[model samples]
Structures are given as C-alpha cells and as structure tokens.
Target: MKVSEKWRKVLRRQPRYWIAIIFLSLLILLALFAPLIPIDPNQTDVANMSAGPSLQHIFGTDEIGRDYFIRVVYGGRISLMVGVLAMLASTIIGTLVGLISGYFGGWVDNVLMRFVDILSSIPWLVLVIVLSVLLKPGLVTIIFVIGCFSWMNIARLIRAETLSAKEREYVVYAQFIGEKHSKIIRRHIFPAVLSTLIVAATGSISGAIMTESALSFLGIGIQPPVASWGSLLQNAQSSLQQAPYMAILPGLFIILTVYSFNSLGNFLRDVTLVEG
Candidate 1:
C-alpha cells in the first residue's frame, strides 16, 4: 500500500491520533490568541488578591491579584514554544548522528555510539539543572539545554533503525545503481526511518515540555515578567496556602499538554509497528 493510504488507515484506526490533533489544535489556538483573550495575566487588583474562583475571575486571583486564567493561557505559549523548538533541534541532531553512524558503521559508529552511551549514563534532569545554572536563564537557553540533553535516546533509536534500513534490499539496489551515498540516504533511508522519527519527535516534545517546566519551577527558566507554566508554579509557591488555584491552573495545563503529546507518540509507535 502507498504511504499516504497507510497514514490514512492509521488515522482512522487510531482514535488517539485525532484526539491529540484536536487537543493540540485547541492548545495552539489558545496560545496563539492569548494576548487577544479577554484578560490581562499581569493586571493586578490588590482588593481581589487571593480571591477564589468567581465569574469575574475565571480561575481566581493570585497573591497579587493577577488573573490565573490569563496567566495559564500565556504560559501555554511559552511551554509549547520551548517544547517544539527543543524537539526540532534535538531531532535534527539525532537524525544526522544516527544516519552517519549507521551508514558508516566502523570507527565512526563506535565513536558515536560510545558518546551516546556516555550521555545516556548521566541523569538527564541533573544535567539540565546544571546547564540552566551555567547559562543565562531564558527561552533560548531552556530550549538549547533541553535539546542538547534530549537527543541521546532518539539518537540510539534512530541508529538501530538506520542499521537495519541500510541493510535492506532497496538500499543495496540504490548503491548498485550508482546512486550517491548522500542521495541514497536522503531518499531511501530517510523515508524508511521517517515513521519512527515521528514517534521519537512526539516523545521528545513532551519530554522537553516537562524539562522546561521543571527548570522554570526551579527559578531558572523563562524568568519573571514573562509567563510560563513553570514560572507560574514557582511564583505560586509562596501563596500555595492562600491561592491553591495559582498552581492548579498552570499545573493542569502542563498535564494536558504532556498527555496529548504522549498519547500521540504512542499512537504513532503503534502505527509504525503495524506498518513494519
């Protein structure tokens, strides 16, 4: 069957696929229009400080009386941005490394695999925290740190896939037909690996979101004056007793976003397995 037909079948067969699509669509829309939304995240009303949920303030007011709802909306923008950029960066790096290592398969493979193994041995969260401390804390730094640390798993996954793919009959035929090495890898090998790459990308995005949130919660990512889910949680720490919703709203957004990506990744993994 054609690849497009297979993708259609997967979409029809997997409810998780479109469920993620809908969830993510809404989230992306919300994040995109957050500024136009009816509330100002930072606009404070001292008289309403620590207020509970009411019609006026949808998610209630924080310690300084900023609207929790708007803060959560704006926070989604930052969280999703970090997740996507980090995932893209990591996927690009991992794909290149895996392709080179698997295609070359000699001292090159050994060196790359050893490096991956060394990175895999480290506790990733610790590495992210250390890096966040060393670098200036901001959106770019968070994205870079998450992307740098997150590639090892995907690199190993793609390496395994590439090793098998390069040995396939089609690949051998391409080589025999005098196709350039780069061309063969780009055309034949990449297409073969694309499905698994999608799965890896979805997983990486969720992991990146979580990592950014954790870093922000630690007061190192997406610093104040600019809202992010993580920073919201960090700022709420002082008012946890007074305004529980301050943390709850942002935390809920994080959970929903991560869950959406995870479900999508699992669905894609299933689709790849079926196609394989």
Candidate 2:
C-alpha cells in the first residue's frame, strides 16, 4: 500500500503536468487582466509602424503600429473562449445523443448513428468556412460554427464507450433497480466514459483553435478592432515584404498554444487510461 501510494503521487506529479499548468495559468491571467495591461493593443502609433521587437514594444508594432503582444494576449482570450465553450456545447449534445442511442439501442441507435454519419460526410473545415462567410464573422459565430460540426466525433466515441459500459454489472443492476434513464446516464455511464471524454474535450480545444485561425486567415473569422490570433496573422500578409513580425509573433503564439494543448491531451489520455 505504501508503494501503491508513492506510485500514485508520482503519476500525478509529472513534469509535463507542471508545464501544462503554467501555460494555462498565464493564458488565464492574460485574459482576465487584458484591459488592465500596460500596452494599448488597439491604439496605433503611425511613427512606430513596422518597428521590430524592442523594450518599448516587446513583441514589436504591427504595420499599423498596434502593440502586437497586447493584441496576442487578448486574442488568446477570444480563441480560448471559442475552444472551451464550443467544446462544452458539443459535449452536451454528443453525450445526450450517445447515451440515448447506446442505452436503448435498436431503432434509436440507428437514427443517431445515421445522423452522425451524415454530419461526418461533410468536410468540417469547408462547412465552417461557408458558415462563417454566411453568418458574418464574430466570436459567437465562430463558436457556433465549430460546436455545430465538432460533436459527431464525440458522439461516436461516447456511443462506443456506452456499448461497453452498458454490459457491465453495475449498469445492469441500476436498470434492474428502476433507475431513470437520465439518472443512469448521469450516475453510472457518465463516470465510466468521463475519462475519455476529458481527453476528447482537450483535443477538441486544439481543433477549435486551429479552425478559428483558419477562418480568420481567410478573412471570414473574427473581424478587426476585435483581435484573434488568426486575425492578427491576416495583417501581415499584405506587409510580408516589409513587416514579417506582423505574421511571426501571433503565429508563434498559435503554435505554442496548440502544441501545449496537444501535449496536455496526450498526457491526460495516458494518465486517465492508467487510472481507469
């Protein structure tokens, strides 16, 4: 038991865990204190336009001389929100469809699976791009577009998990004891599948961030005055010959953020599998 406890502590205290925690901590801090930060993200200094990184403007000024660092920080907040809230929206939708389909089976399962199949047939990025172009670009629009299409994969994963879990004795006993469908789902099946759900959700965040960036890159995502990492990148395309920093700074942030999420998701998948 002493050895078991020691192993448990070691498992929980991985170095990658510290890195994920620190990355997420700074992201949260940047978002919460964006307005209070010293730099003016939107205010442009015409004289300083296209300046490279310096103590005066740490991440350098963009073509319009806005503070790149400050914009990137705030863009982190917007992109993070789209990833998180959109994933939560997808989770709720996918979990419900999967639970009902897997628990009841027969015709219900067929219908839900077919719906997911139809959704999966559509190219997700193309669909989002079309939708973003049609709906007018904004934060909420991006979130909606992402959540609407991203739930199918989660639904399939949850359905597979539920099929296995329903055969387990606890689930059988719960049904035999006359527990409600919702109760069984909330209590028994959810806990069984939740570890995988967390990993899927973490991965979804990275996907959503990339999708939003792509949309912004195409000029159909979050609009100007309101920044996103993708929107920040858009500014540099025209000035690439003269001001490459416009593209480089936010591009690095996007890469770092996505890599952090991917690494964290892999770590969580391994950790959660061990726990299960």
Candidate 3:
C-alpha cells in the first residue's frame, strides 16, 4: 500500500472505532438488563404523576406515574430490536437482489431495477403506513414495514459497489479459474460489499427507530403497557405544556440515541471506504 493508504488504515483502526464498539456494547447490555434496573416501568404512582426529575424517580414519572427512566431503558430494547431486525431483513433481501442484478446486467437487471424504481417512486412513509394498516400494529409489523422501505438505499449502494468490484483483478481471476458464479460471488464480492452494507445498515437503524416512533406516536405501534420511546413521547405530548419533562426526557434519549448511532454509522462508512 502507498503511504497515504497505510496511514488511512491506521486511522480507521484507531481508538475511536473501539470507543464506538464499546458504546454500542454497553447500550445493548443496558437494554438487555433493563429489568434488573431499580426502576419499575409499569407501576403507577398516581400520587406522584408528572413529577420532575428526583433521586427516587431519576428521569421522573409520566402522567400515570410510570417511571420515565425505566420506560426509556425498556423502550431501548424493543426499539433497538425493531431497528436491528428490520435492517437485517432489508440487508439480506436488498443485498441478494442488488448483487444478482449487478452481476447479470441484462434483461434480468432491467426487470429488477424497474421494480426498485416502482417501489422508490412511492412515498416510503406512506407505503409503510399503508402496510402497517393492513397488518397489525406491533413489533413484527414495524419491522416488516421499515425493512421493506429501507432496502432500496442498500440495493442502490450494492449495485454501485458491484459495478466497480466486477472490474477488480481478483473477480476476473476467479472467473478465469472456472469458479461458479455463485461460488465466486459468495467468496469474493460478498465479503467486499459486506463492509459497506454494515455501515449502511447502521444508519438504517436510525431511520427504522424514527419510523417506529412515528408509528407509535400515531398510536399504531407498540401498544400500551409496552414501552417505546415513540409511544412514551406520544403519551407525554399532550401534557408538554404542563409536564414538560415528560416529553423532554424521552425526547432527550431519542435525540442522543439517534445521534450516537449516526455518528457511529458515519465513522463506519469512512473507515470502510478507506479499507476498501
């Protein structure tokens, strides 16, 4: 590698990357172990409804006096799960479609690209809303809706990467060696494209979380008794004028979560492109 290239690689592997990894690890651990935390998510304290931050309540209590801290911690699990699963669904389906279309590059490509365009033309949020309406409003529905809409970006990204990768010397050598298309793709192209996909997938999680929050804000996502940042916000919206902290608390978590994920995603994308 050239000097610039070597330096880039070193930068990509620096402590910031490790910090992002550690932050994500701890967030996930917090979500998983939410139940073990001292706060009670569902317990109603009618006497203390709409209380501001206190040592006992930490983030404070909601209208029904449900602990905001506990709800946020619990909400972390479901929202993150939806984002992850939805991204996985989109990545798997979109990667396969993109790879096949890019590799074949003929009538097959035309058909698939046309389908993608058709889907892309529709307002993604509208499409998600329509689909969610058709199905039940819950975790599975949210995942399916977000995944279906989220894949188009990945498909386009993968196609561009494949277009370049197909010209790489190794790919041609693999073909010359009489490797089957599937085998060559699986062994070579997939690994190379996977880094980009992972970076893109991280960004997609933010969108997925926002979508779920939107759905829940409209009362179509994770029903009551089930905690989600969006639903948590929804419950607090009406009382914002009176109990501002109720809305502010969950909103803070939402903002922080989205920013953290986005920062990590950008970091991944920059590092991966350099590695490529």
Candidate 4:
C-alpha cells in the first residue's frame, strides 16, 4: 500500500493520534508565524497590570501587564526551537558514535561503549544542574548541555540496531563487493537504523523540552526578559494566588506539548514496529 494510505489506516485505528497531530501542528505553526500576530509580547501596559482574560488580551495580561497570549506564543518558539536543535545535536552525535562502534566492533566498540557507560552512570539532573550553573545560562548553553548529556541512550539504541544491521546479508554483500566502510555504513547500516533513530529522536524532542522547562523553572535555564514557557511559569510564581492563570496557561502548554510529542512518538514507534 502507499505510505499515505498506511498513515490513514493508522489514524483510523488510533483517533487520539489525530488530536496529537493537530495540536502539535497548530503549536508549531503559531510559533513559526508569531511575528505576524501584531502584538508585541513585551509591550506592557502599566494601567492594565494583572488584568484577567478579556477581549483585549485573550489569555490575560501578566503581572507586568504584558500580553500573556503573545508571550505564550512567543515562548513556544523558544521552547520548540531548543527541543528540535538539541535533538538534532544529540542524534548526530549518537548516530556517529553508534555507527563507528557497531561497524568496527572489537576495540572501537569496547572503548566507545565503556565511555557511554561511564556517562550514563552519572545522575542526569545533577549533571545538567552543574553544567547549567558552570556555563552561562542561555538558549545555546541549554541546548548544548542537554544535547551532550542526552545522546548516551540514543547511542546505545543505535549501536544495537547497527550491530544487527552489519551482520545482515545486504551488509555482507556490500563488504564482499569492496565497498568502503563509510559507504557501506551510509548506504546499508544507516538506513536500517533510521527507523529506530526517528522514534528515539521524536521522544528526545519532548525530553529536551521538559529538561529545558525544569531548568528554567529552577531559574537556571532561560534568563529573564526572554519569555519561555518555563521562564513564564517562573515569573508567575509571585502572582499565583492573585492570577492563577499566569501559572496555569504556561504550565498547561508545557504539559500539552510534551504529551502531544510523546503520544506522537509512541504512534511512530508502533508504525515502525509494524513495518519492520
């Protein structure tokens, strides 16, 4: 069957996936096109401080009277960007390490796998907190720190997949045909492991977002004046009783976005397993 037909069948079988797709699509579109919305997220109104949701401000004005709606939308841009870029960074590093270790085996595998084990043994949150504290807190720093720490699991998964792929008939034939190790890996092993990578990377995006949120909530992720869903929640702490929506709105977005990605990742994993 055609790929589109297969996807439609899956959607029919799992209607909840539709909700996940729609919500994620809307979030990405809003974040990408936020500049066209005409509202300055930081444009505050002293007179309208702490105003509740109204015709003028849909989600309400924040403690400083900035449009909460625009802030949330803009914040999505930052959060999503960090998630995607960090995932890319992790995926690249993981794939490269896994490819090398799996294809070469022997001493290369031992060295790389041992390094991965050492890194994996460290407490993730403690490591992230230490790195965030040591480095200057910003988007790039958060992305780099999360990416560097997040790749070990992906590396293990890809390594296992690559180990299997390298022993397959096609890979053996490629080797027999005098194909370069790099060519064999790129053409044969990488494609075989691509499905696993897709599922892992999908999950990684949500993980990165949640990590960024947690760090920001702790005041070490995204800094002030810059609005992120997490940072917005941080700023809302003082006004939680006075304006519960301040906390609710950003928290709700974080929950929904994370859930949507996770659901979508599960869906993708199922599809990949079926195909395999």
Candidate 5:
C-alpha cells in the first residue's frame, strides 16, 4: 500500500489519532518558526506590568511587563527541544544496551539486567532532583540528567523484544551464515524491534518534557532570563491571582503537549501490536 493510503487507513481505524498528530505538528511548527516573529519574549514594557489580555497583548504582559505570548512561544521551543533530544539520547543508549544484553545473553545479560534493576529501584524524581542540585542547572545538564536516567524502561522493553527477534527465522539464518553480530543485529534484530522502539520513544518524549517541566517548576531546571513552560509557571506563581492567565496558558500547553504525545504513543502501540 502507498504510504499515504496506509496513513489514511490508520486514521480511519482510529480517528482520534488525527487530533494528536495535528496538535503535535502545529506545536512543533510554532516552536520552529517562533524566531520569524518580531516579538521579544524578554523585552519589558514598564507601563504594562501585569496587564490583562488585550489586542496589544493576546496573552497579556507578565509581572515584569514582558510579553506573555512571545515568552510562551519561545518556551515551547525550549520544552520541545529538550523532549526530542532527551528521547534520542535515551533511545540510543537503551537500544545499544538492550541489544548487547539480549544478543549475548548469559553473563552479559545477567550483568546488564542487574544494573538496570538497581537503577529502577531508585525513585526517579528523587534521583533527578539530587543530580540537579549537585550539577549546575542549565538546558544541557537537564537533558543529560533526564536522558541518562530515563533509559531503564526502554532498555528493558528493547531487551525483551530483541530476545524474541533473535529467535526468528531470518535471525537464525543470518547466524548460520556467520554474519557479524553487529550486521545481524542492525539488519535483522533491529528492524524486527523497530516498531516497539518507536512506540517507546514516542512515550519517552512526553516523559522527558514532563521531567523538564517539573524540574523547572521546582526552580532547578532552566534558570532565569531564559523562559520555559515550567519556569514561566514558577514566575507566575506570585501574581497568579493578579494574572491567572500567565500560569494557565503555560500549564495548558504543557498538559496538551504531553497528552498529545501520549495519545500518539497509544495509537502506535495498538497499531504495532495488531501488525505483530
């Protein structure tokens, strides 16, 4: 079937998936093109402090008189970037670790799986908070902390998928032909598990975004002068009664973005299970 037809079929089968896809796409586009807009997120207007939404300021001016709309737009850029990069980092680490452990099995599997278990035993938020406190707070540090610690689940998932994939006919044939381990994994095992990986990765994006937001909300993720959805919420807390929209707008975006990714992930998981 043509790719377009396949998408149509999938959308027809699960109509709500279109909502998730469209919302996510629009958010991504807005974040990407925010630079083309002329508004400065941090530029303050002394006369407009805590202004309500109006024609001049759709989202209104923040406590310090900064444009709330532009700040939210720029904040999306930060939030989305963290989500995507963190997902990529976790996926790569998880895939490699899972592949090696599953393919080699025996002692290698025992060691790696045990390590994963140990990490999993720790409360993720506590660990992230401790690390955030120890290290300097910034975008790169936040991403590194989230990406490194968040891979345990993905590794477990990929390992299980790889174990089954390696037992498949094509994988057995490749082994019989003396194919290199890496080549066999790349060509056979990886492809077999790709759908599962994609689903896990999609879910991971929302997790990462939430993690970033939580850390920022606690005043440990992205610092001042730089706006993020979470940091915006932190800033709006003092003036919440005066300008509730300041808190509401960013919180709404965060909820919707996370929900959209989760919806898409659920749809992918359902489709992949059916295909399998």
Candidate 6:
C-alpha cells in the first residue's frame, strides 16, 4: 500500500491522533498570533500584584502585576520554537550520521557508533548543564545543545533500521539496477527511514521542551524579560506561597504540551509499526 494510504488508515483508527493534532495546532496558532493579540505581556501594574484570577486576567497577575495570561501565551512561543528547532537539528544530524554509518559499514560505522556510544553513556542532563555553562544561555545555544545531546538515541534507532533495510529485497534490487549509492539510499532507504523519523521528531519535541524548560528554570536558559514557560515558572517560585497560581498556571501548560507531544509520538510510532 502507498505510505500515505497506510498513514490515513492508521490515523482513522486512532482518535487521539486527531485530538493531539488539534490541540497542538491551536497552541501553534495562539503562539503565532500572540504578538498581534491585544494583550500586554510586559505591562505591569504594581497595584494588581499577586491578584488571583479575574475576568480581566483569567490567569491573574504575577508578583509584579504583569498579566499572567499574556506572559504564558508569549511563553508558549519560546517553548514551542525551542522544541521544534531543536528537534529539527537533532533529527537532521542523527539521520545523516545514522544513514552514513549504516549504509557504509567498516571503520565508518565503528567510529560513528563508538562516538554515539560515548555520548549515550554520559548523563544527559549533566551534559546539557555543562554545555550550558560553556556556552552562553540563549535561544540558539539551548536549541543546539539540546539537539546535540538528544541525537544519540535517534542515531542508534536509525542505524539499526538502516542496517536491516539495506539487506532487504527492494534495496538489493535497487543495487542490482545499477543505481548510484546515494540514489539508492535516498530513493529507497530514506522513505522507510522517514516514517521512523516522524515518530522520533515528535518524541524529540517533548524532550526538547523539557530540557529547555529545565535549563531555563535553573537560570541557564532563556534569560530574563524573555517569557519561556521555564522562566515563568522560575519567576513564580518565590511567590508560590503568595500566589500559588503563579507556579500552577505555567506548570500546567508545560505538562499538557509535553503530554500532547508524547501522545502524538506514541500514536505515530504504533501506526508506523503497523504499516511496516
């Protein structure tokens, strides 16, 4: 069956796929239009500091009386951007390294796999923290650091898949047809890898978000004045006793977003397995 047809069939069988897509889409839309939305995330009113949720501010005001709702909304943009861009970076790097290692065996495979193994052995969070210390904490640094650490799993997964796929009848047939190595890998192998990559990308998004948030919470991520969910939570930490909602609001959003991505990734992985 065509991949698209199989994908459609799988999606039809899983209601959560639609739910996840819809929820994530709404989040992306909200983030995309956040700037245009008539809400002042930064405008503070000391008079309203520590206020509870009201009709005017459904999420209430922070310690400094900035509209919590707008801050959260803007925070979503940073969180989502970090997650997506990091996922892309990791996926591309991992996919290429895996494809190369698997498609061409011998020393290439040995060296690459050894490097991956060494990376995989390290404590992921610790490694990220160290990297964060070495490089200045910013959007780009967070994205690249998270991606660099995250790619090991993807590399191993793709490498195994490629090793198995290279010996398949279709691949052998392509080889027999005198196709160039690159063409065979791109045309035949890549399609198979693409399915797994989609699942990996989705999973990576959740991880990236979590990693970025954790770093930001530790004051090594998106800096002050930038409203990432992590930074928002950090800002609220001291005020937790006075304004419990300060911590709860952004935390809830982070949990929900991560859960949504994880659910979507699992659904895609299951569907891809069935397709295979």
Mark the regions of model 5 whose C-alpha exceeds 4 Å error after superposition: 273-276
Query: Of the candidates numbered 1 and 5, which has the greater TM-score value?
Result: 5
lDDT of 6 by residue, 84-121 (tens): 99999999999999999999889999999999989989
Model 4, which residues run further than 4 Å from truth?
none
Deviation in angstroms for 40 in model 6? 1.9
> Per-residue lDDT of 1-276 in model 5, one digit per residue for the tens?
554565666788899998899999999999999999999888999999999999999999999899899999999999999999999999999999999999999999999999999999999999999999999999999999999999999999999999999999989999998999999989999998898999999999999999999999999999989889999999999998989999999999999999999999888776665531
The weakest ten consecutive residues by lDDT in model 3 span: 267-276
RMSD of each: 2.0, 2.5, 3.2, 1.2, 1.3, 1.9
lDDT of each: 0.89, 0.84, 0.83, 0.92, 0.93, 0.90
Models 1 onward score TM values of 0.93, 0.92, 0.90, 0.97, 0.97, 0.94
Clashing pairs in 5: none
What TM value does model 3 have?
Answer: 0.90
**Model 5 clash tally, residue pairs:** 0
Inter-residue clash pairs, candidate 1: none
Order of candidate numbers by TM-score, starting with the best: 4, 5, 6, 1, 2, 3
10 residues in a row with least lDDT, candidate 2: 1-10
Q: Residue 3 CA error for candidate 4 (Å)?
A: 1.5
lDDT of 2 by residue, 207-259 (tens): 88898898988899988889898988887899888878788878988887888
Model 3 alpha-carbon drift over 4 Å, by segment: 1-25, 273-276
Quote the positional error of residue 30 for candidate 6 in Å. Answer: 0.5
Q: Over all chains combined, what TM-score does candidate 2 have?
A: 0.92
Model 3 CA lDDT for position 92: 84
RMSD in angstroms between candidate 4 and the native structure over all alpha carbons: 1.2
Q: Tell me the spans in candidate 6 whose CA falls farther than 4 Å from its real position.
A: 1-13, 273-276
Candidate 2 runs further than 4 Å off: 1-14
TM-score pick, better of 2 and 3: 2
Question: Taking the tens digit of each residue's C-alpha lDDT, what string does model 4 give over 1-276?
Answer: 666766777788888999899999999999989999999998989999999999999999998899999999989999999999999999999999999999999999999999999999999989999999999999999999999899999999999999999999989998998999999998999999998899899999999999999999999999978879999999999999989999999999999999999998888876765551
lDDT of 3 by residue, 181-270 (tens): 999889888887887888888888888888898888888888878978899889888888878887777677677777778877877666
